[model samples]
Target chain A: MDNFSFQNPTKLIFGEGQIAKIANEIPKDKKVLVIYGGGSIKRNGVYEQISAALEGHQWSEFSGIEPNPSFHTALKAVEQIKAEGVEYLLAVGGGSVADATKFIAAAACFDGDPWSILSEGARIRAALPLAVVLTLPATGSESNPNGVMTNYETQEKLAFYGRQLFPKFAVLDPTLTYSLPAKQVANGIVDAYVHTVEQYLTYPVGADLQDRFAEGILRTLVDNGPKALSEPKNYTVRANVMLSATMALNGLIGSGVPQDWATHFIGHELTALHGLDHGQTLAVILPAVMAEKREQKHEKLLQYAKEVWNISSGTESDRIDRAIDETRAFFESLGIATRLSDYGVTEQDIPAMIAALSEHKMTALGEHGDITPEVSAAILKRCL
Target chain B: MDNFSFQNPTKLIFGEGQIAKIANEIPKDKKVLVIYGGGSIKRNGVYEQISAALEGHQWSEFSGIEPNPSFHTALKAVEQIKAEGVEYLLAVGGGSVADATKFIAAAACFDGDPWSILSEGARIRAALPLAVVLTLPATGSESNPNGVMTNYETQEKLAFYGRQLFPKFAVLDPTLTYSLPAKQVANGIVDAYVHTVEQYLTYPVGADLQDRFAEGILRTLVDNGPKALSEPKNYTVRANVMLSATMALNGLIGSGVPQDWATHFIGHELTALHGLDHGQTLAVILPAVMAEKREQKHEKLLQYAKEVWNISSGTESDRIDRAIDETRAFFESLGIATRLSDYGVTEQDIPAMIAALSEHKMTALGEHGDITPEVSAAILKRCL
Candidate 1:
């Protein structure tokens, strides 16, 4: 195990009727700005819960935060924060809304142009206190300090993180997710699964607890993701998936370990250039990354094959192949097609992806920084 | 899956040589009190690390906190805090020092007699801020708000908890345990194992991730505990066990599950009466609790049998029995005897233990409040 420091201070208010508890979490004195994506919370009854919870506090609303959480849309919310004197932020939708809220929180308090926070890696001195009413379980944004946003002008997706961005509290009422469309539910599952494996699947670090935790999350997602779609209102299934997603990227499993995020960075480029859904991009890219990096990740792949997929009866090469195939099959079973051609990406599109990787200085990726632009292009060709 | 609100705010500064970072976690303005047990830290060079970390801070020392930390000893520290106007506390030893510091932190701010804080469950409105430099990893007091303190005058051991008691931060350097005696290391392993099972080994609520996490902690301890005894300076083994011990009782596994602390409650009586170490009492009592409550915990015991002990391919009853026996053997392998008689307790001592449980109002224990005094007596008889 490697040396690490870990702390996540998000108070997770989970299970049924937890939305109401946010009333006690956010102070009555703060003027709140409730942020949401495309008014889904309004249709799903989450808006009412937020309204009721914030009844005692002075508050306003910001709707139309999009998936991928565009940098321009978040800048508008930051402007609104300054205009309305918003002291606290309440994100009321899924990862997109929460991600936007994180950016808006920091951008509102930032001294200069906020885009530089993402593009130039500007230091974040402060941020508005933020909380979340998590209606979606993907991205694990509710409990983590990470946020990814797209700059429509530059057509680039980038992540920014700081200690100040951790949410003060997160309301995760899995019941709130009952009305989600099946495609979105599948996307959530695939996103969480890839999140877990990205931190895992890199190399062995002898971090036993972290490895087991990563495996536990993967196993939970595999078992609960399908049930969540087939029986949308099954509280047990929904709760398990919701909690698993939060735990997947909440700094627990990834701590004191080397993490390979080459797939995510490549997937982000796909999302930026082609407008693929984040989860869809991950499904298209991850199996290819697994195959291309097999030699580097050989030992961990065998362990993953055994512990997660229960495939122990094969030559080492056969087991690795079976694990990757099982992973792609799992995503396909969730109605997510794994092949890039299945989504109409071709040899023609590969060059743009490679160029995007180079432009963003993502030429060297993966845990060992060995996934150069050429290697990423080869992985993309495998996806083809 | 139960409705639950969970938060643990203790910043875990983990890894080797992370002690110096505490200088940043603590405010330089506060008058600090460094608390520790009977100078194990002094002999182990942990004291030098802590002293070096607090070099610029105004700090004083309070020593002689014993195992099963006495309330009287903590009270003396509270008085010292009052006299010196100490505004912050830094517990520098293991669970005992941390537990004692918790009581002292709360008692110093209480309006009246501090004993009521333990005896009468006084409402704690405030507490002095505290942090920890954890030289011992057994009790998980570093990352959790819960603490156990013994009222030596009353011959009673009890637990107390409050939101205010959560440590501000914890410095977990696994290397700190390198010089510990084999008995203490073995005791730490048993303590952490029992902690994991107390939260688990109850009825399942479809809490797959929780179950997996509990099993992960148990597996890590089982794999790493003996190695810790033999290869005391092996960083990976020490780190895994240290991290597992902290994760065992940090309120994560027990958050949404039914927890059977009956073993712990029963163990406390044995300790309060016969003066067994906390870990020894757990080793002596847990298998008996499993035997006594086998019917109620049937499903989970089977799961535990297969997952942690890998005892499949037997009748369910056979599996449960084998699992219980394996648990006892594991403890014995650690040089901690698994029977009450092994500790010199006889049938004559059972009544005193039962009387102590009754005196502490622990007549009904375990997850479902089903372990009555009679059931506890049965468990004690099984132990004998």
Candidate 2:
């Protein structure tokens, strides 16, 4: 296995009525900014629970952090935080709000233009301590030190990572997910499944234990995800999905191994240009990326075929084909479209996406670092 | 799943030559106390590597922490640490040294008699920061907050847990295990396997994902352990075992689940009384414990049978029996004796061991709060 240093200090408070724990987790003396998206929390009673939990704490609310968590919208929250001298941030909605709050937390402490942090991918030195009341189980932004931010003007989305911004505490109540729309639930499952695959389907670096753990999370998602969609009120299914999403990308599976995040990097362009949901874009791109990178990731693909998809008894090429097909099938099973055309994207948008990828001098994508811009275009063409 | 809060903050630095990186992990300004067992490290070049890494650091060495880590021996190290005003501790050997250093770190800052902290099971309020260069893969003391300390005077061993005493860092190099004896390697595998089983093999409790993770760790240990023993220098096998041991008991598998550590608690008594190795005692006790608690833990036993041993085509009773038998056989395959008679323990020791367990009043020994003292004694009798 490769050399690695790992430390995640996020304290996860999980189960029913955990939202009431907010008052104890955060200091009452600090000025807190509770961030959210739209007014879903109000209709779902999460807002009332959070407010009752806040009690005498010095806090205010910042609403309307959009679905994709755009830099343009997050900067407004940062401005309010700076103006109010907020010392802590509590994100109380879905992954988008949590992801935006992460940017707001960093931007509140950053000296330069906040947009530069995303565009230039600058190292973050310090940020206001952030906590979350996670009502959504996608993105894993609650426990991990990663957040994807979009620039609306440039029509671009990018990810930023720093050790300073991991949540101090996250309260996950699976029952809070009972009120979520079915589409959002399906999107969360697909998002979490792809997260596990992105970490696991790459070449194995003799990290057998980590590989098994990655596969375990993958299998759990596939087996339990359909049940979660049908029975939204099933506490066990929601709890399993919540835990699986947290474990999927919380730096546990990626330890001591090379990671191929090219699918995510490519999918961001689809979200940026076509305005597709983040999880839906991944459903469109992952299978095509796997098919294109099959030669380099052949052995791991075969293993994934047998272990995750149960596609044994085939030649290597046939196994890779079946594995990619199984992946697309799994996403489709979640009611997510696996083709760009299925989502109403035309062939006209493909050239612009390809140009954006090539403009970045995209030459390395998979585990072997060999996915070029032409190969990316080929993958996208297959998706079309 | 049950309500749970989980957090582990130990920074794991894993790979070859990671010991050299210890200089940067610890604070140079703090007065450090280096603790270890016998002089095996000195003969194996680990001591030299640590010495070189200690350049320009204020540090002192306290050697001779024995196996099982007695309170009598740990008191001496505590005294020296207090005299030197040590601000941090560095444990450089196996789990015994690391476990001993945890007590030393707590006891140095503790008021009143240090043994009171163990005997009274009082909450530890503060402790000096501790780090480790783990040369053993058996007990997961390097990454967890729990430690077992023996009272040599009473022939008693007890476990104490405190949140304040987790290690600040742990350096794990699988290459460090290459020179270990064959018996130590076998013991390490059994120790890790039992750790996983203790957390698993309980009632399902809606923790399907945790069950899968626990089973994955068990499968990895069974698959890679023999390869590690036969080819001692095989990096992949050693790395897999090291990572498996860490994942097995680092609170990852136990979260949101009912854990039955009755076998570990009982195994400690056999070790303290008979001078048998901790892992060997566990091998002897676990199968008998399974047999004794089969009725209460029937559902989980069937799950374990189907998942780990793959005995699906049998009656429930037959499957439980086969699973228990297979567990004993796996331990024997590691060259461990799975019966008390194989270790030369006679019938006279059984009543005294039962008395010790009764004194502790461990009423809730198994998953369903079963495994009374009488049941524990019956399990011991079966082992004989």
Q: Which segments of candidate 1 are over 4 A away from where they belong?
A: none
Top TM-score: which candidate number? 1
Instruction: Flag clash pairs in model 2.
Output: none
After superposition, candidate 2 runs with Cα above 4 Å error? A314-317, A346-348
For candidate 1, write residues B1-384 as lDDT tens digits.
Answer: 888888998888899999999899999999999999888788878889889999999999999999779998998998899999999999998898898899999999999998888888888889999999888779999989878888778776777888999999998898998998899999999999999999999898988899899999999998888889889999999999999999998889988998888988888778767889889999999999999899999999999999899899879999999999999999988889988888899998888888888887898899899899989999999998
The numbered model that scores best in DockQ is 1
Candidate 1, clashing residue pairs? none
| CAPRI rating of model 2 | high
Question: Candidate 1 on A116-153: residue-level lDDT in tens?
Answer: 99998898899999999898899899999988888988
What's the lDDT for all of these models?
0.90, 0.87
For every model in order, the TM-score on chain A comes to 0.97, 0.95
Give the per-residue lDDT digits (tens) of candidate 2, residues A1-384.
899998988999989998888788899899999999989999989999999999999999999988878898888888898789889999987778888888988988998887778888888888999998999898899998888887878867777888988999999999999999888988898888888888888877888888888888888888888888888899999999999998888898888888888888788778767878878988999999888787778889998998788788868888889888888888888888899898788777888888877776556777767777778788888898
Per-residue C-alpha lDDT of model 2 across residues B118-227, encoded as one tens digit per residue = 88887798888999899989888899998889887886677788888789999999999899998998998999999999998877787878988998898888888888
TM-score of chain A of 1: 0.97
